[model samples]
Target: MPQETFTLQIRQIRLETDDVLSFELASPTQNPLPVAPAGAHLELHLPGALQRSYSLLDEGLGGCYRIAVKREPQSRGGSAWLHSQARVGQTLQAQAPRNDFALNEHAPESILIAGGIGITPLLAMARRLNRLGHRWSLHYAAPSPDRMAYRDCLQALAADGHGSLHTYCSSEDRRLDIAAVVRASGPQAHLYCCGPAGLIDDFITATQDRPPERVHYERFAARHAASTEGGYEALLARSGKTVKVSAGRTLLDAILDAGVDIPYACSQGVCGTCRTRVISGTPDHRDECLTEAERQSNEAIIPCCSGALSSTLVLDL
Candidate 1:
């Protein structure tokens, strides 16, 4: 299915930090927006056909959506454009909320670990957990207090005894011990983390002994793809066509260039929207969406970022 775009009026804008800004969006006609779960995200369709995803932070707020944007020093103009050009009273187009990191409500306990801007989704999780009277804790880390968003709100939660809030500011020589945090969560606790590659990697390593289904995480960016020496052939079984997937180009791009239409979001392969059945092929899977079992089955491929291990790959469509 194709994504439907809706216009959102910017209701408020606030500077959360030196490099971060929070934007509040509402339907132009005051209609109620779709309610999203704890860890859902909205895709903002920016100018020049650029789309960027931001975690929805307005947990308890109805009829409104809130998101925080952090200006990346090395951004390709997305954050910079929002920080400089976006303003209150302006209307922007956005897609409906979607979740790839959903909280397990039935878990005995929940542990949320957030780093810097990664706090967006975790904040929502905290609020939802508090509302449901569920046991949860948040471990937030940032370079400094000045760079952290929603500090006062998190502190308020701590003061109200909703849950424990442990903060680590690297500038103050406080480092987050991932191993200790995981161990402290206990065996029955469900752990969720979102952050830079280093923090996520360490968290995964620390929790390696635990059940894989009990640990969840989401990454803002995809890992760098390894280089391939030559191009591969992709056969579109339904269309009865063969396209060459170039060394540097993705299988998705090759298919699109051949005039095939497909549904896709977060072309980086994190959304699992571009997953297509594999008629016959050994896929060199690079997507984070598939699990070990799915990868081993070779039943589908996320063409947006994955490639073929065999010389010729045949796809269902």
Candidate 2:
């Protein structure tokens, strides 16, 4: 099944940094969009079927949703199009906002780490925390000050006693030490990080001693390298259909080719949209969303980047 979508008009576009642009989006009819919580993301239906997800900033900004994008010349077309072609007053189709990186404003302590353009969602969390008078801090890092987005806003938030801001710019000889930061935080502090793959991996490794519930992260791209070494059968228990996953092919494509409908976004498995229940069989979990305990239970699977450890997987499609 497809998600419901609506038209959003680009009201403003501001250069946040050298490569990052902030887009302000609102309903075409000037209606207020749904109240998006901190860390929520909106899926933009771009031209050429290139759907991309961007983090919704914390502030509503008078009912308009704000998002920041960093132009990636080497990657897919989303960022490139938005940077070189998109203009204010243009309308775009978008899916309803969804959140996998929700912030816990009530936590006793919140520590946010952002690298480069990954500051999008954490900026929202900082504002919400400031408004609620909660204790929080943001550590933002970029190669240079010219590339750090939201520097003024974050500085203002800190200057007003809302929260504290710490910045690290490699060009100035200050480097962010993830392990040191993790070691310094209190054990109970709810840590959140969104950044490059190396940063996320370092954050996870540094926080391994803390309670899993207290550590959180969001990735714009999949961390795991998906393998196509399939030698299993996916049995759709409810539909009474079986799809043979042969080597050099993915189970998701095979199942979809068999005329089965499965909702998926970010085919890379960073998004948990395709998580499905497993009636039986152990899943070779590769998704970043599933916790270790869930993988051990073998009760669910993310077929987008996962496969079966067992010869047959009875899926509850």
* Candidate 1, 59-109: lDDT as tens digits: 527789999999999876679889999988999888888888999988889
So what's the TM-score on candidate 1? 0.92
Instruction: Quickly count the clashes in candidate 2.
Output: 0
Q: Model 2, residue 277: what's the lDDT? A: 95
User: What C-alpha lDDT do the candidate models reach, one value each?
Assistant: 0.85, 0.86
Clash count, predicted structure 1: 0
Candidates' TM-scores?
A: 0.92, 0.93
**What's model 2's TM-score?**
0.93
- Estimate, for each residue in 1-317, the C-alpha lDDT of model 2 and write its tens digit: 55677899999999887888899999889776777889888888888777788898765668788999999878588899999999999999987778888898779889999999889999999989988998888999999998988899999998878688999999999999989988888877999999999999899899989988889999877777775788889999978999999988777788888898886767777777778999998888888877789889999888888998889999987
